[model samples]
Target: MKIVDLGDFTVDTQARRLYRQSEELAAEPKVIEVLCYFIQHADRFVSLQELHQQVWQGRVVTDTAVRRTISKLRTLLGDNDTEQPKYIRSQMKRGYQLVCPALPGEEPAVQSHAAVETNAAKKNKLIQSHWLKQLVAGSVVSALVLVVAFVLLASPVHLHTDYLQVELDIPGQKASLALSPDGHYQAFVGRVNSGDKWQLYLHNRQKGQLAKVSTPVPHVRFVDFVANGAAMAYVGFRQNVAELYIQPVADLAAKPQQYVLPGLSILAGPLALPNNQMLIAGGESYNGNIHYYQLDISTGQYSQFSF
Candidate 1:
């Protein structure tokens, strides 16, 4: 069987199996095929079209599908798109290439008759020694378990009842708090001074750096970070009317997109949805009473839900 040797893994061409230090890795067949193709063309960059033609055998597949396959292969190979890839590297606007060296397969050595007999004798001795080692290892493990149990029983466990307290030095009172999905940054509405209005501010949990996210606004009722942590949505009041705005977290100076719900005063919400949609709860005066409505961000349409 032809076996190509990668630094940390070996690929069996005939069996179509990948092994890491003699341990078999559970990878999909397509992933292995992709890996083999990369290894075959390890010398240069393999374009996306070449991968589709050779690895997929000219099957009708979307670019997204190919990218997903590459992502899965990267995960299996212990690589990532964020970090500097060790095995597979992506060529910008092109395709991917195997960065690591994969040596060609070598033929197995032939054994002489006397050498074969000697190997058989050594194998039997190894089997006997293996049993003895197992017994010793079991005894050692049992003793270790007993010692650990005794130590755990003898040691008095102290309950930790201390709560972590974080203090932020702010010039004014803080309002709503919105933590990022990754728990790295926190966005909150805070007033700079007693007479000033509430504005959006961001706090870095790791660095303890606080910065203003928005300019001085009248009031920020609600704030929420997007799922991707790239942007945030907030409901702010202007001239006694509530409006929804979305701002990028990285560049707070950029103009935010404003979504105005005519005749409806937003009481709460601006919740983010998948694909740039937002859910809002507000009320509009109709007839003689205020009727609650749910507004869709995409179409700017509202439907009456409650009174």
Candidate 2:
């Protein structure tokens, strides 16, 4: 479809553009998908899970991603999730609705340029006043931020600081933890507290499920999830040799694909990157050099850079 009318704005679907009269507005493809989907279900509620499954096409994305798309669409429509929402009606955990889905052949009545300018001038004055208030608020916020940072660093955790910490009862957990790209699962290294070597455990926060994900090689130290969130990469040391391992989060029963990382006595990271690549930070310290490497999971090859 070329043009979609939605009250005050016109959306050009094929062009991936949004316009308010003659002024064209930037809209990303994903944002447009969200907007058009709302129009298709105009005045009806669409759940977040529905948007994730239908709009996102069952792709692996976090709830945060869906909310961000809604925010972007609302911005384009001159609306907000709270305070000054004009076009989209959002109900907490219920869904979203298009408030004014304009019927075909209906357009906003043209206003005289003089009248428009008069309104703009009034808005400009109000905006100037709003900005002055914001300037004062910004300074207060900066001071509060500094105080919060000092308290977090110098003192222990407290509700008076406005941050909550929840400790999950997983298997014997240690320090290193990795949250999946989708923010649904967390992987931590722990043991059974029965004189067992440390390995990896995956926890699904949404489902409240936990599982052990250990490779054939023991003593896993560092772990990270792949970009797609269905798989993970980790580093383990066995017999004074450090090896890199990649395995699927859905299934750890099968042996993980492992690669021998030569020359590095100590390994720290397997940072996820795009196109099945990750960053490995470790080098032969005894050789008087520590380095970071780009490891290709598909080919099991590592490339180092200078400086």
Candidate 3:
């Protein structure tokens, strides 16, 4: 079995496994394929189109799926940090490249499927063993907590009946809702159904009509109006990476320009500021811990708030 040494971890190409020291990290099949492709083309930028052709085997797949796979690989490889992705580096508006050097090692004598299966079984057993120990150790405390929770839930509770409710006919769950500075249009991200992807939509209060914004990607996380409601700025996700985009509101058919923000994974609450700048909240971490940032809409430059 051929092994590729990836600094902190090793990739067993024959077995299709990634290992950090003695621990085997579980990664999806597609993620593994993507990682291997990056390693094979480590010298240059691998464009999204190339990835779609090679990784997905020329099959039609949404850009979101590729991005999601990359995200999963980043998490598994401990390259989740936006400021410095140790393994894979994303080139804005281009493709991704493997920053880490992978060296080939001597092939193992045993390359049979049974051997690979045995190794995978051993790794799973190790994981289950560790989980069993933790479960046993926490059983007593968990039992006590469950008892308390049950008692609290069983107690008679008074419910408030006096409450005012007003419902508006809006499609999907509204997220990152923002009103235009001129109060003419309301922009928000919405997913029509459970299986549908979130998309950006504009609600015109004057006309009482909803219009869909032409997003390049399937997922639109945040949106806000710029240029005095003549233009719109939004954070869009493609292949699990967040990018800033600006488009003319008058002509939604016009293609939007994508902006590269190196370390931001999730962006939210985009507020337009003076002088073609924006105030936004986003983060590099997966836990949704975010910080305020000021972005120059024209230049795509950003600086994080300190305090």
Report the C-alpha displacement of residue 126, candidate 3, in angstroms. 54
- Which 10 residues in a row give candidate 1 its minimum summed lDDT? 284-293
The digit string of per-residue lDDT tens for model 3 on 1-307 reads 2699897788887678777764565556888889888888899999888999998989999887788778768766757566787889897888899998899864434446676688768745754674586598589789988876776678636423344343248656878877777888888888879787888888787788788887887788888887677778888777887777888877778999876554577776677666787777778766867877766777565655422
**Per-model TM values vs. the true structure:** 0.41, 0.45, 0.44
| Alpha-carbon lDDT, every model | 0.69, 0.73, 0.75
> Model 2 — which ten-residue stretch has the worst lDDT?
102-111
Q: In model 2, which regions exceed 4 Å deviation?
A: 1-167, 171-173, 192-196, 285-287
Model 3 per-residue lDDT at 212: 88
Residue 286 CA error for candidate 2 (Å)? 5.5
RMSD to true structure for each model, in Å: 21.8, 20.8, 16.5
Model 1 Cα lDDT, one tens digit per residue, 187-225:
888776878777888888888998877543468878877
lDDT score at residue 133, model 3, on the 0-100 scale: 64
After aligning candidate 2 to the native by TM-score, how far in Å is the CA of 133 from where it should be?
A: 30
Task: Quote model 3's TM-score.
Answer: 0.44
- What's the residue-level lDDT of 30 in candidate 1? 81
Clashing pairs in 2: none
Ranking of models by TM-score: 2, 3, 1
**Clash number for every model?**
0, 0, 3
Between which residue pairs do clashes occur in model 3? 1-108, 67-239, 67-240
